[model samples]
Target: MDKIRIKNLELFAKHGVFPEENALGQKFLVSADLYTDIRPAGLTDDLNASIDYGMVCHKIKDFLEQHTFRLLETAAEKLAWSLLTEIAGLKKVTLEIQKPWAPVGLPLETVSVRITRGWHTVYIALGSNLGEKETYLRNAVESLNQADGCRVEEVSEFLVTEPYGYTEQDDFLNGCLCLRTLLTPEELLALLHKLEQEAERKREIRWGPRTLDLDIIFYDDLVMDSRDLQIPHGDMQNRDFVLRPLAQIAPYVRHPILKKTVGGMLADLEHSQKI
Candidate 1:
């Protein structure tokens, strides 16, 4: 990745905790490092092939001047998200917002908040065994596409497969879809739960029948083991249902933890079943 740097871009904005601060406004300095591949623009001498730092500077000034927030943290966070959402070719951004006129009694030069944000590639598995299964799968994909900060990149063909855990129910319509999202894993999981509830999913029985099941199979090679979520989906390597569909879309996407590609895992799982 290459870098485009913008430094010490000063602007007057009303962003502070004090009431008078908001009314009078204050001077702030913002700097950003944008990460992207500039090869196309460099080789072709075309500005359209890369991001424009001049335009980004203007946007930052406008956004800061238009919005009023109490915390620089809030301002920086929202600004980072705005840049990531609005900028077409920007891959990652590191932003620093500096406030020089602080009310603190100390003689410090300045106070600033620095943050980084970017889009992540995620693979999600969709499954439903009850009532109009394929519709549920398609609806899930549509819902993900409609959600803010999420773009559905590709979807695998649906497969009819038997249940995984408690296998007494009818077969399920299973598939996987690739997503580009700005949300963190936890935020993504929350949104999925909301979608499931919209589908009238029941949680009374563990691994029991459900109207919709959405699982995050992979999140940008992230490895996590928090109470609420697990990356690489816990059992994706062992489940033919998940790997079969995921392999179709991202056969070469490697599991960060296991050091195996999706296709390789599917092959191993199938071979083990034969034995």
Candidate 2:
């Protein structure tokens, strides 16, 4: 929410496509905007409460000098990720890497790459109906926690519930997980699919029994409609299995489109069922 700007910090580094350019080294200018909550630091006048700009600049300089990349895009991406991963109390970062002296014959001002990187809050619903369901769920959580750029913050207690889509299959062990990650929604989806495949998940029938089922229930309050995925999972509000566990971890997590908390949604479902 708050901004700490570091503008046009110059660095001399050996980063270029040409062999001669790499050998000789070049001058590059970097600009970054660090986003975080600085209220505590400002109010208490505590240095420890906030990130030190000097340290950030030094870290960036060192990173540039230590690594050699042929493309500015690669450098910018790595720098942005490094800052987000290394910096404390950082919510998001916008980094720009500028290379002024280009080999292009035209007299251009500068060539640069700019990108925004941040941590996203995602809610995942995990379930399994076959082959040690509890172990499958726990292992899935463990795998996600061990993943790079992803952190499992909270997990709801697993609940044993009857199958939802088809009554023929075994009852599923279901739960919810709260995660903070640097991966985009698409990337996260891919990782989930990979984990499922590793568990030998079969897709012969829609909502069929599986070794493990991990679904993206919500992603940072994002409301998305795509052929492959949908955010605020289309049927989550109506599914007691999903809301029951999700409410345990995030009772107050509001649905972006419905503007109702998970607890409220669960209550509404209960009320409707009774009537």
Q: Which residue runs does candidate 1 get wrong by more than 4 Å?
A: none
Estimate, for each residue in 9-104, the C-alpha lDDT of model 2 and write its tens digit: 999998889997788888999999999999999999998999999999999999999999999999998988888888889999999999999788
lDDT of 2 at 190: 96
lDDT of candidate 1 over 96-205, digit per residue (tens)? 99999988879989999999999999999999999988888899999999998899999999998988888777888899999999999999999999999999999977
TM-scores for the candidates: 0.98, 0.97
List candidate 2 stretches off by more than 4 Å.
none
Residue 155 of model 1 has an lDDT of 100
Please, what is the whole-model Cα lDDT of each candidate in the order they appear? 0.94, 0.94
- The alpha-carbon RMSD values of the candidates against the true structure, listed in the order shown, are 0.9, 1.1
Distance (Å) between predicted and true CA of 221, model 2? Answer: 1.9
Report backbone clashes per prediction: 0, 0
